[model samples]
Target: MLRSHDKCVVYIKSDDGEKVVDEIKTFQDAHWVSSPKALWRIYEFNLTEMQPAIINLQLHLPGKQAVCYWKKQNLQSIVESDFVHQTMLTEYFKMCPIDIEARTYLY
Candidate 1:
């Protein structure tokens, strides 16, 4: 089990339904906010002014990233050119899909 210093609960599920793990105190050791520029754009949208909208947005972001790969559309370049298009893309490839079975047999 892992726990955050702030006492936030984190859960991890395995591909097989056999393992259900609970995480207890952890630290924000990594910078999840990959692009500061993108975050700044969100701030520019004045989310603080719209409390409900901001809350809803935060809730949906993680699920959106999981099924979508936004990294393929070359977001870094796009953001560099236009600071406004910083929102995560829904149709782009965020990560390369891996074949677990193939990897297991390799070594």
Candidate 2:
């Protein structure tokens, strides 16, 4: 039977022979305690947040890209909206020439 306050014992062998060490054995502590990033996550803190935000590029043939529209919305109005024609890929291509920094990134 184990006592209420008793900790798990670990045995280590050295030149002096085997030595018993009392410890609160846990896989979580062993894996996460030594890492700063893991400790930050243990405290439930956000490690990284996108600054400018990321853009997901969409691929499609000309005039075949998907568009967002409500069921009640007219098909003609949906086709007329300027946003329907604009995708991340199109915007990236449009901005690449104008913005010098954009040229550094590969599509």
Candidate 3:
């Protein structure tokens, strides 16, 4: 089955990184970056629907600027992006064949 949820990362930056991090926790999960380059993987909303919230990241942070990175993705691409996850996922696939087809079944 096709995964309908979109993915994104919200970068919240501030002179007060700690405060920003704490304040940011008030928001929903699966939307903020996990790395230093300001990555946020937000699955709370689909691509077009999430644009406004991503834009608001800039306004939401205190005494700093923010950014958002959004990418359309599939299971393979998501797993491939992370090395450790990729390794484990590759192993899992070797042991158990994925019932989901690699691509959409279409004309």
Candidate 4:
């Protein structure tokens, strides 16, 4: 999209007046109708292609993991729940002590 000695003229409008600027840069507007990516987005097509993908692993200390509850739920009951105390990190720690296979892997 760019070539040597190529420059673009931009006109900016403000409360004061219109100002003209000359700059050499790459400008892309995905929301514009002229953009192919905009058409793909409008048709609900895949926008990105990634290899292996991405994953989120939650790590927290004991009794410090996140908990989801409704407004009507009692805080005391939620704190006492078994699921509230367990997290992926805590489970891994528990498994490493009992399962010899788990001890072989690094955290």
lDDT of 2 by residue, 7-37 (tens): 2233555677866443454322232334676
Better of 3 and 4 by lDDT: 4
Q: What is the lDDT of every predicted structure here?
A: 0.40, 0.68, 0.38, 0.66
TM-score of each: 0.17, 0.49, 0.15, 0.44
State the lDDT of candidate 1 residue by residue for 1-107, as single tens digits: 44443334445567885655432222343213436546777778653375333322222352332232366677556445533433334212222135444333311
- Candidate 3 achieves a global lDDT of 0.38
Cα-based lDDT at residue 55, candidate 3: 24
Candidate 1 local Cα displacement, residue 7, angstroms: 2.4
Report, for all candidates in order, the number of backbone clashes.
13, 0, 10, 0
Give model 1 RMSD, 1 decimal.
20.4
lDDT of 3 by residue, 1-107 (tens): 11223434345568767424433443354343435323333433342454223321112232222322347646565444544233322443444545555223221
For candidate 2, the clash count comes to 0
Q: In candidate 2, which residue ranges exceed 4 Å CA deviation? A: 1-48
TM-score quality measure for candidate 1: 0.17
User: Residue-wise lDDT of candidate 4 within 35-92, one digit each (tens)?
Assistant: 6767888998876765544435487766778898999999999999898888767887
Error of 4 at 105 (Å): 3.0
Higher-ranked by lDDT: 1 or 3: 1
Which prediction has more favorable TM-score, 1 or 4?
4
